[model samples]
Target: MRKTALFAALSVTGALLSGCGTAERLSRIGRAPDMAPIADPTRDPNYRPVSMPMPAPQDARNLSANSLWRPGSRTFLRDQRASAVGDIITILVSIRDQAELQNTSERSRENSESMGIPRILGLDSSYARFFPQGFDPSRMIEANSNNGSQGTGRIRRNEAVTMRVAGTVTQVLPNGNLVVTGRQQVRVNHEMRDMQLTGIIRPQDIASDNTVQHDRLAEARISYGGRGTVSDVQQPRYGQQILDAILPF
Candidate 1:
């Protein structure tokens, strides 16, 4: 009885919490989603400095007399690409993937056994008194077993995405690699689409147009999702989701 009461209380609490969120969304039923204010990314509590392994420092090579170019410089003229912290650059995101898999297996087993006391001292004659009529001591015990199992699995997936967003260089690692982060939000009617990207990039990978491809990024993280009336309707109810999680088959 106590366990039942505790479970009921927890369910009530979860429903109340879910209701609060629904009420907030309901208040904006007819209005468009509000845009977030622009702020400093470095000021966010979750933001941290990036660290990476660095190669041993090398001495700068002396340039030839009267030479216009400097050692370790990509261009003779001033480079316009993003190389310092806080610089902005464009990111080209393109992805296309597909996968298919199938597997099958079958197993079977069978066993049989027989045991008997054909002769035990001179007491074999007494079996007729305690055993069934016409008892056969040669086959007193017998057992047979058979088991079989079969399984099959299959999976198929396909995905594609393309977008362009500007990212800010958040940190310059000791090895000269830059850490970049960006976010984009678009609101149409009552629905809002959101995209976030973060990764480490090399300065040399940036093209002459100040843009870098997604493939050039290392340790990349990309997210694309949306929230609105249609999205909420498509999701299962809080109570149903909770039951699906806790109920045992």
Candidate 2:
């Protein structure tokens, strides 16, 4: 019995040692993997991060229209007189006859009456002094002289009266001389003349919406030429009579 008990104890100890050796070998294998060096993320030149660009603010200097109208520049008025004359002629020639004039005159009178003003008020003609066309108020920068790169300049609107006389033509003579003598009631039309506003924009204040205002003029005129004869003497008087009949002022 003592021998059998001693043999069982030895057998149990050998089994435990064998199990421990297997477990240690597995642990050694796992530890071997940990001994390798970790990879450096920065060392990879090809692993570039995706990048995005930021949005830029709108630049006014890039607008071509805004750059044309510089403030306080008189270059815009170079041909203004000729333009105004052309516009007046166009309006006059378009009248066609006394019938159209009567219609236009009646309309003007009605408009004036509706506004609660005198019916026979003088029809005054004037030009835009410094009309700002396509002018964006938000883009208007105050004038500055110090900054060369800054768009700091003055912009002006200008207007003038080409002609201002009371009356309408009773007849456009066959010889191209208008007869103004008749006192018969007549009419006139208010029309828009083609006028251009020219200017420039400074470099810094370029984002302005610079545009011209159209059809702002309310009055126009007609001209006639005559040699030193009875026609010349009677021409102005006839014109005055026609104006009185139509305008009644």
Candidate 3:
């Protein structure tokens, strides 16, 4: 009976060892029932780089349209509405009176004469000549008379001319000409000036402020404004002649 019991114990121990070896082999082969699959992150097409785009900065002062024109504003002429080119505008400047002119003339004459310049006391006056686009003196003389005569030239009113004031009228000459007593002179030309007119469209003037939002996610609670300008240059009928008078002879 003792020999039979020993053989039976050995058989039971062998069976237990065999069962543990089978479990080890199954784990090595990845055939174990509870084994998890390996994760491959690179296999995902949705994977992206670590870097991302940041949100843009907000400008607080830029909120209002008038803010653009305020001193120290970020938006300059280039950014303003009136900043655009091709804008046309006009401006007018009136001449001052005779007493004021006399005072100015006296000061200038004193200054020039004191500086070792010639002191001439008289108004400078001259008749300005006006002709068509193409003027021929020979043709003009021939038109006056068949025989060339000094005082027989025909002056046509087709050319428009205007009297320009020059220097200070020191004295009235016997003939109605002004004795201009200075070096300065007046010029005749197309009067042109640039003027800027800015137009602003406030948020309230447009649709409701609530309709527009700051950020895509947030509601717009701030007021907004837009601005623009109109510009033009205006000239008189005889602008070209005016330019010529202003130029130094």
Candidate 4:
């Protein structure tokens, strides 16, 4: 009875501690757990390791164990499907995009004023002795101004890419989606082409011939391009780029 009571009290304490240290626990999300010679939290005061959720490997089951390959069996005519890591799947890349924009602005403003003295008041003649020979009271009260501005801009862009690359499944998710990654590099004379891709795909999306379109992949990232001596020559110098960013004139 005493041991049972002690166990219940320890369980309650553990629940309370975990509930209060939620954020503290998340701080070690990316850290590796303690390896060999696993230390007890109470026995090794200096040893500390973190625990976090991690993706588990897919369960591999052997279907051949129960299925037989008879001369006229349906299994004999089944198509090969990519459902595991290391399986290769062809990806068809197709992309086309275009954009165009134009902007224009214009502004104009003008102002003018004038004042004249009445001859009956004689106020203009009262200050005649202190005024310059060519000075006029009416002209001193007049002002005129004019301002105008015009701006225009235009931009156009077009991009088209089409190619094919084979990708290998690097991981299989619990839901049966495959995480794929692929890279291709080709060299021709003085030029080189580099291509890379990564994404997730469902087995059902794969064609009977073991091929999948790039647009069918989820979270897909595909990049294709080339670089060589000719490319370097076409690029602007670093100094020029910095000047473009900093100079207004």
Candidate 5:
């Protein structure tokens, strides 16, 4: 009874806390979702610097005497690829995945045991006359057992997504890799879509037009989601989510 009362109290407290958002939504019943303000990504409280193992720095490239062409330069003019912090680069995102798996397992066991005293210190001969009719000491005890079990499991999944977004070079690692971060938001009638991407890419991977493919980015983190009338209706209530998380069954 005490446990049940405590759980009920917690549920009520959670519902009350979640009601604050509900009240805000109610005030904007007929209005479209507000768009987020434009701000510097580096100023965000969640922003953090990226660090990794780097090899020792190498000496600068030596230039030839009176040569206009520089060694290791992709073009005679200044290279246009994004190599420094605060530069913009376009990212082309494309993903497609499909998987299927099935598993089965089976187990079985059987055992039998028996024990008897056919001739123990002549006692069986002495008690033979007094034993019950059709009784046999050779089969005094016996046991038999059998066990079996079987299980099967299966999984299937498919997903596909394609989009493009411009990202800013947030940092330049000691090894010449560039860290990039980008966010895109679109608001439609009573709905909003949000997308975010962050990763590191090598300078050589950038094309002449300043575009890089998603596959070239390492340690990538991508998110695509939204929140609005349709999204709210599709999600479970706060109380239901709390119960789903805490309930044993």
Candidate 6:
């Protein structure tokens, strides 16, 4: 009997351990993934840019002394713009919007239709004799309608993120546009905030200070998010969320 009890206890313990492992793995979801930057673009074992339609890369042209400015040329005299792969530049983030509208409308309509039977037709006196004082053949059909609608809508939103982060130029397109990507993570007191950006930018868009505005970027994919213990506590439990998704009210 003692041996059987020991066996049952061991089995329960094992089951509990297995459940804990699974719960730990699932709890990591929505938390920041292993926060590792790509070691190399081309040589990395798993570093492939998303497959999408992009401009074909153009071939370099031979330059002579008479050529004042050749594409992708790095001259010793002028300021450098992020035109080539592996170059870096800073991006400024800015955003804001607001609007309001109101509409008022009112309408009223009345319609009355009637037919009279004259004394010559020999019906007016007989109808009046049979009818009460409120009854009248001249106002046989009457309809009154009133309809009014008024609506007002207002919207206001203000969001701004002003920070600078150096981004590497990942690809240079044929037309001299640079594909830039950057990611930054800040961790403080168990909370981690991550910012990432990827976009195509023209060489001329980079100012002499080597910075470009976020609004100027084309095909920009910017994401600002976070993950931490605080964030996890703010979200519903996985079991509750699953029930909410699959269960009908």
TM-score of each: 0.86, 0.14, 0.12, 0.54, 0.87, 0.62
* Model 5 TM-score on a 0 to 1 scale: 0.87
lDDT of 1 by residue, 1-249 (tens): 999999999978897869897787888878877777777778888887777778987776677898887655666766778999889999999988889999999999999999998999999988888876688889989999999999999999999999999999999987789999998999988888888899999988999888999999999989998888777888898878878988996
lDDT of each: 0.88, 0.30, 0.28, 0.69, 0.89, 0.71
Which digits, one per residue and each the tens of the lDDT, describe model 4 over residues 1-249? 999999998777656645554443355344432223422222345422223234676676545656556332224656576778778788888888899999999999998878765453666666667775656655566778999999999999999988888777777776667887776777665555788787888788888778899999888889887755455457675446557877999
Query: With candidate 6 superimposed using the best TM-score fit, by how many Å does residue 184's alpha carbon deviate from the native?
Result: 1.0
Q: List the residue pairs that clash in candidate 5.
A: none
Q: How many backbone overlaps does candidate 5 show?
A: 0
Error of 4 at 178 (Å): 2.6
Writing each residue's lDDT as its tens digit, candidate 3 over 43-81 gives 336532222233465554545555546543334543221
Residue-level lDDT tens digits of model 2 in 174-238: 32222221111111222112221111111222112221111221222233332222323444543
Task: TM-score for candidate 6, please give it.
Answer: 0.62
Model 4, C-alpha of 208: deviation from truth (Å): 3.5
Task: Choose 1 or 6, whichever is better by TM-score.
Answer: 1
Order of models, best lDDT first = 5, 1, 6, 4, 2, 3
Candidate 1: segments with Cα more than 4 A from true spot: 1-15, 60-65, 71-75
Flag regions of model 3 displaced more than 4 Å: 23-36, 39-249
Give the per-residue lDDT of model 5 (tens digit) for 1-249.
Answer: 999999999878986879898888888898888887887888999999999899999987788898888765677867777888899999998988889999999999999999987888878866657875756778889999999999999999999878899999999999899999999888988899999999999998999889999999999999999989999899998878878998999
lDDT of 6 by residue, 18-109 (tens): 57845764777665435657554445565455444656676766777776776544665554777677887998877543444555555555
